[model samples]
Target: MDLSAINPVLLLASLLVAATPLLLAAIGETIVERAGVLNLGVEGMMITGAICGFAICVNTGSPVTGLVAAAIGGAALSLVFAFLTQVALANQVASGLALTLFGLGLSALLGQNYQGIKPPSFPRFDIPLLADIPVLGPILFRQDPVVYLALALTLATWAFLKFTRAGLILRAVGENHDAAHALGYKVIRIRTLAILFGGALAGMGGAYISLIRVPQWTEGMTAGIGWIALALVVFGAWKPLRVALGAFLFGGIEVVQLNLQAAGVAIPVEILAMSPYLITILVLVIMSADRSGAPASLGRSFHASH
Candidate 1:
């Protein structure tokens, strides 16, 4: 194994790129869970978004429009989950699983014409002076716009949960929907909106994979990133910053193992490839033994009587 063959800087840079989708999906789910609703259809939402974004970007020749379409597609699909769970009082877990299956099948249909197609290029901004720094510059500044957006999103989510009145109210509804309803808060509406937000973000994350990561459409291109994002939320205890931190850790593992494969390491190719996912999941699963910080009413159906 030629350890020297791996370029540390490039490895870290790729890690950031790899983790972007995971962070986006995980953080969005964190919000949904915090609102006391658990949507397990992230995989479904992501794949739909991936196809939507890829198709739009290819036709319109604009990555921005493609991303917007992705978000809309995701939100529209999530509307089904919202109505079923919040309004119809259907089972959230089952609804989410159904949504995933539906999304996979639907995306496959939509993406049939888009197979083997490449998407339009997305521009990255180079911070004038900061991007000029020796080692840190390329790793930090020379990144996809979505990477910066994901970071900003983490900070924004943290602040919203910690300092905003709206945030407090959302937290309250999540903690005790009955009490929140008694106090005049609209539990179902809040949760529906949260679910939509989660879907939109998950969609964007999916688009990132097709439009930026692989920049191509493939059946099951998302693999299990959506499921991994769910695990990340649990690993991070549903906190925005911690979720981001966990994404980076798992993302780093993804990059490291790929580097190992490229370096022609003696380890079995299958083992090297799977180690990032298996180790990340096992480690995070082990660390998540204490679920004390989870939102109290998470995954519970809330029927508001007003």
Candidate 2:
């Protein structure tokens, strides 16, 4: 392995970009799971958002519009899950799986015409003075707004879950819906809101892939990152900071694998291609070994017994 072929600065910069989508998706899933609703259709929502964002951006020539539309599209699709599981009382897991399948097919159809189309570029903002600092400046200051937004969202989520009364109520609802219901808390209402919030974030993540990362529309382009995001929520033990760390870890692995492939490492092409996923699986296995941090009422259907 020729380490000299790799620029550590560029690798680190790419790491932040790579981790952004995962962080966005995982953070959204964390919210959903913490609200005691396990919507396993994050992949579905992500792809749907990808196509929607891509199409909108391509047609109107506005990345911002595309991103907003993506969020809206994702939330709209997730409402299907919310109605089934929360309102209609359908099985969360089955509904979630169905949502994923549906999303993939839907996105494929929507993106069929958009294949190979490039998107408008989002401007990167360089912080003056601070952005001029040695190595850290380029890595940290020279990034698009989404990267900074992702970091802000993580901090906001952490604060929300840790300090806010609303956060406490959301946690209570997740821990024991029955008790929360007894306290006159609207369990379904809170969960529905959480589900919507998660869906919007997931959609934005998908948009990031289409509008910024790859800067193009491709069918099934999310490439299982949504599943990784779900696993990351668990891997991070349902905490925002931990989730960010998990995302960065995966992002680093992805960057390393790609760098290895570019450097013409002797490793088999297929093996290098799958290294990030294989590592993610290994990490998940290690993280799930201790599941004590999980929300107690996760995946359970809630019905207020009058």
Q: CA lDDT, every prediction?
A: 0.91, 0.93
State the number of backbone clashes in model 1: 0
Model 1, span 147-266: residue lDDT tens: 999899999999999999999998998898999999999898999999999999999999999999998999999998999998889888888998999999989988888888888889
Per-residue lDDT of candidate 2, residues 151-218 (tens digit): 99999999999999999999999999999999999999999999999999999999999999988887
- Stretches > 4 Å off in candidate 2: none
Worst 10 residues of 1 by lDDT: 276-285
* RMSD of each candidate relative to the true structure: 1.3, 1.0
Per-candidate TM equals: 0.97, 0.98
Question: Model 2 residue 166 lDDT?
Answer: 99
Backbone clashes counted, model 2: 0
Best by lDDT: 2
Q: List the residue pairs that clash in candidate 2.
A: none
